[model samples]
Target: MAEPRHTRLRRRTLVGSAAWAVPVLVTANAVPAVASSMKTDLAVDVVDPPYDLDHWRPKDEVPVYRGPRGHRIAARGSLPPSIRITNVGRLTAVDPSGSVEIIIRDYGNDRASSAPGRLKAGTTNPSVMWTDTTNQSGAKYKYTCRGELRPGQSIDIPLRYFVNPPFLHAEFNVLVAAWVEDQQEGDYDDNSLRIGHVPWISVF
Candidate 1:
């Protein structure tokens, strides 16, 4: 005898649902493995970014050191804003070979409407700053790190972020963030220690 029509329908539905669910389960299970692959022995991280300028423009112009051969590019290129970074890795960075770099972005405050790093209505308790690489204001803080950084060693990376039209007295939130793009980091987590300021002080 043929199976009842309703019973056949229910079996078919369950089979189809199980087939669809199998792929989701596999994808979910693979996430941990993929994340673990990103692990590396090299470790370094940002410590803090201090901003004392109020109603000042970050020095955007690239300047040169007055060397014997006229103005020459210093070993460490210069940009205005500087943030401190420390080597938190188990081993010191490879000398004269490995390098540490940092970039800077000013994602505006609670009022900001940008997609990646927009803050919620109120409070800055757990600030989540986003890095908008396409943003013109986003710039690499250049410095020549040419030596060994024993664990807990810190260096200030000079950075600069400027708005073309200018933000003379604008009020907004600022997230000064740095990221480890090389093998120095075990995980790809963008960390920041905000140097908090009054709402009006974030003006660029």
Candidate 2:
């Protein structure tokens, strides 16, 4: 039988200490609804990871490495699971160009470095963070990427994701932040979007 959503949320409420009422609200949703106040200049969309970019590469809004277009891609937490990017901005723009790819680099023993793991199936501990990496395809556009957000503008990035490990449980939530920036580092005018992943509950 499928685990009750409330049961799953209870676990997060306990571990995440999210909020007293948040779990009740989340449990109430038969479908997730975007929060009204959280909307920013960028439209964020979360979707299941893609299998291959061959189909995604043909989109019209696919972000090029360099263009006059400026974007802020930000996500938080270190995890090893699945997450969907949803559009939260008022802008109805879509990432037809397929220019962005999420990359996770294990920070390893270096506590000072950034943790870039994806969402996981089970177990939440030692919270970590993820900073966007510039084009994994070695493409960097030279356009004047600014932090200016117009209505209905956003970057929809699809990730090809999977978790391989000492399989014990199915998934867990990894906290993360995101931004629309030209490169992985430095200060871009755009503010980082901090989002927390709901536990990627166990499937096995």
> How many residue pairs collide in each prediction?
2, 56
| lDDT against true structure, model 1 | 0.30
| Candidate 2, poorest ten consecutive residues by summed lDDT | 5-14
| Model 2: per-residue Cα lDDT over 35-102, one tens digit each | 33323322122232112256531112211111112232122122212322222234332221111233
TM-score of each: 0.35, 0.24
**RMSD (Cα, Å) of model 2:** 17.4
Where model 1 places Cα greater than 4 Å from the true spot, the runs are 1-81, 95-109, 113-144, 158-169, 182-190, 193-204
So what's the TM-score on candidate 1?
Answer: 0.35
lDDT of 2: 0.25
